[model samples]
Target: MLKNLEYLKSGNEKQRRAFKVINQLNMMEDLKIYSPILCGTIPLSIDTASSDLDIIMEVHDFSGFGDKINFLYGPFPQFKLKRKIIRSKLIVKANFIYDNFEFELFGQAQPVTQQYAYLHMVIEKYLLDTNPSWRCEIIALKERGFKTEQAFCHMLELTGDPYEALINYGLRKQII
Candidate 1:
């Protein structure tokens, strides 16, 4: 059994196993996994405990297949798998055949230019300061329709400082 991030941080055996699995999974061709909570790209609230793992990948020639390919290719042979594909998103529900371990994968669409831009900005800023609070602020801004998260991420990527003016403007509005 794999431990969650909290236990992983404390160097528990389960954590080690989980990390090992993550590494192995990463090594698989055409797969990328990301967790905003785990990456500190978003606030770590209690809600993250039950969050499903999120992944993005370039499956070879998956343009038309999208979710279907994920459904067919994602599961281990022994696992009983259920899958759904909506637009570019793929959702899977499965239990490990051997251990009865339950897991899910939520696949997002291949990022568009806007999303890539947002992610780039976010990563740049995160690299500069690693401030979880700031990341949360960006997410909030995105949710509030200021811009796509990718756009914000891209802004940060380009300037390394974003939301400074916007944040101040918002603060002044609240005070007024």
Candidate 2:
């Protein structure tokens, strides 16, 4: 399912660069790396020029990965990074910024197949195959300040946590 990611290597220069950086990160033998799941507007094909790169990593190890990554990328010629624990999940994440483009690493202590990132990818594939029109609505909703997952729920009039909203939507729509 993720093999289609190879096409992203042909995306614009920035996307290509992001892909390269992600590949480099994946090469770290010590890290329990999962396939880099691309999220945000890029995969939906609704991204604006300013959209940044968002990649999800589901892994089994993160004991000291944050500090290690910080040390390795601290001197990124173009990016400055900040690491923090997401308040809800308490998962450590590192956000990297360079001018208007950004790259984020979300470390999930779960199998990639069991991660929400996998579900989002599934939703994306389902929407792409069966409801491409939703992509436009997503872009419109995003223009109104909703994130991608939020836009998915808002477009379907579902509420609450975006993850739960996705499940509810899948159930209600009989698409799960």
Candidate 3:
């Protein structure tokens, strides 16, 4: 987890702002949101200056909740935002100047639940170890056609126990 924090810190100013926005959103109690997958910046190599924030929020429900949440973010007066229902998820796209950020809220979704669980397990086991090599493995997996969330889930699936297969793969690829 420290490495992940470091990864965020290494990002440019806009990425750092995106991270702050995510933190603010997550800290909202009315949203009932959790398990934020801070995707775009950390894993996708999206430059802070050019990329939008991509975040997935796990929620218990999605009925009329997106608009309500969007309204709650009235603090950001200069931003233009839109909320739409996308399947079982509520998608929020907020833009200001040239910067865009997105939030996807998943409600009672099985895939979201599974992914969050897998992410939690993997982070708890591997990320806490502060291994730069493991971080490299994550980066490599992200580079290899896997979505940030998917790659992490795949790593969790492949290793069963954290730091074993992922670290080995990184070492073999000289990414560690």
Candidate 4:
């Protein structure tokens, strides 16, 4: 479910459940205008029980995107919406818990593929595929409180900021 997301239907239990929940809420179709893309730990198969479903979107109309998110998820458990500036871009984010899965809807004017979350997931997936033995070590690092990207950075011996380090490494290696 990293790119097209259809594979989620046949993936592991959590993945299948994620697909069902997304379909049940009509998330993809409803947010199709914004190019909603699933990007997060689950797709990388290293998700812990606490991992939330992260859906990134390309949104130029902040007002409309905020309204749509509010209308769609404001009633859900622990639903919250906010606008904030990240990386010098004002974006909208919504969070809610439903069916035992917490959902994070992140919208920005930039293309979803260019967003850090998506890029990180893609790079991590690539590393996982090419280095099978690192999976357990990465997960172990995460269990010790390192974030996903941080865990990857630690394995690579990247010393700078984990997020930036990951991107820089990926760009130099052409992984993303």
Candidate 5:
């Protein structure tokens, strides 16, 4: 029932709605859902009216999984599909805007940085586990249009890659 993610259940109405969708999606046994780790402001429990859902999912087959999502969302009224180079490797990301939230899909074959970002979600979860005060700071940054990773870096006063900062956090805390 996605019980461990207590933040989502306690968030605002929009977050609850997003959680419903994610929970439903999580039940799809045919697909490799990968926990649907909530990213962005949603997981931080600081969802503003402008907040949108950011779910990072790992799938076995990108095309097949995307086709299923496209069929369900009906081609995403406003959608974008693109490729970005990360860590010297090209990774494709498909974004869909549904109910004013952004849903992003990343395949398992993505680059190192892309994979690291997903892994960062886990690290963020653990960090928030002990102290959630950073939620307020992150939400404010997100409202100003800073990306989730950027917000993490800025709030933590960490330099370089946000993923690396999180990795260091995990190392220091011995949570990895």
Candidate 6:
């Protein structure tokens, strides 16, 4: 499912719509050079009405990437772009709304496989598939305003910075 967007076509209503919007915008082909992968709640079927589409990519050229995305999706409603450092690593992000689904394109110089979004999704999917009950529990936590990682951490009794803790758990369990 992570290798391509094809699975989304047969997923729930939201996933189908996500597939449409992504294709309609020619997102994959346009960003093909960067190797885009949609990673987040939608694919896991744990999303809420407010969940945004998170597309992660490996980008080496910030300037070129920013220029390309701005050219392609900049005209969309609420489109915005920014570059900032997170955990001391540079990242480029673009946000926009299309077909009522918020789209967040996150790019970092690191490999997509190494990005936190991708890693988290892999671990989250594993956990959700591990216990059917946890899916509802995690979603319930999300509805209560917990971020995905936070919800998972809370449910797992992980006690540190949720992000790092979850990743650490994944690493220890070889799940990420």
lDDT order of candidates, top first: 6, 4, 2, 5, 3, 1
Q: Report, for all candidates in order, the number of backbone clashes.
A: 8, 0, 0, 0, 0, 0
Please give each candidate's TM-score. 0.32, 0.73, 0.42, 0.97, 0.69, 0.98
- C-alpha RMSD between model 5 and the true structure: 4.0
Clashes of 4: 0
TM-score of 4: 0.97
Q: Assess candidate 1 and give its lDDT.
A: 0.37
Tell me the TM-score of model 1. 0.32
The regions of model 6 sitting more than 4 angstroms off are none
Residue range 1-176, candidate 1, lDDT tens digits: 01134444445443344445544544223333322122222112211222223223322333333454345445654544455675445543333321221233333344421122234333334433545456455545555554433344454453433444333332343521
Q: Could you list the CA RMSD of all candidates, in the order they appear?
A: 11.0, 3.6, 8.5, 0.9, 4.0, 0.7
Off by over 4 Å in 1: 1-17, 24-27, 30-47, 63-176
Q: Ten consecutive residues with minimal summed lDDT in candidate 2? A: 27-36
| Model 6 TM | 0.98
Off by over 4 Å in 4: none
Give the candidates in order of TM-score, highest first. Answer: 6, 4, 2, 5, 3, 1
- The lDDT values for all models are 0.37, 0.64, 0.47, 0.92, 0.62, 0.93
Cα lDDT tens digits for candidate 5, 16-61: 7776776665623433354444455566565667655655556556
Q: For model 1, where is the 10-residue window of minimal lDDT?
A: 38-47
At residue 140, what lDDT does model 6 achieve? 89
Give the top-scoring candidate (TM-score): 6
Backbone-clash count (model 6): 0
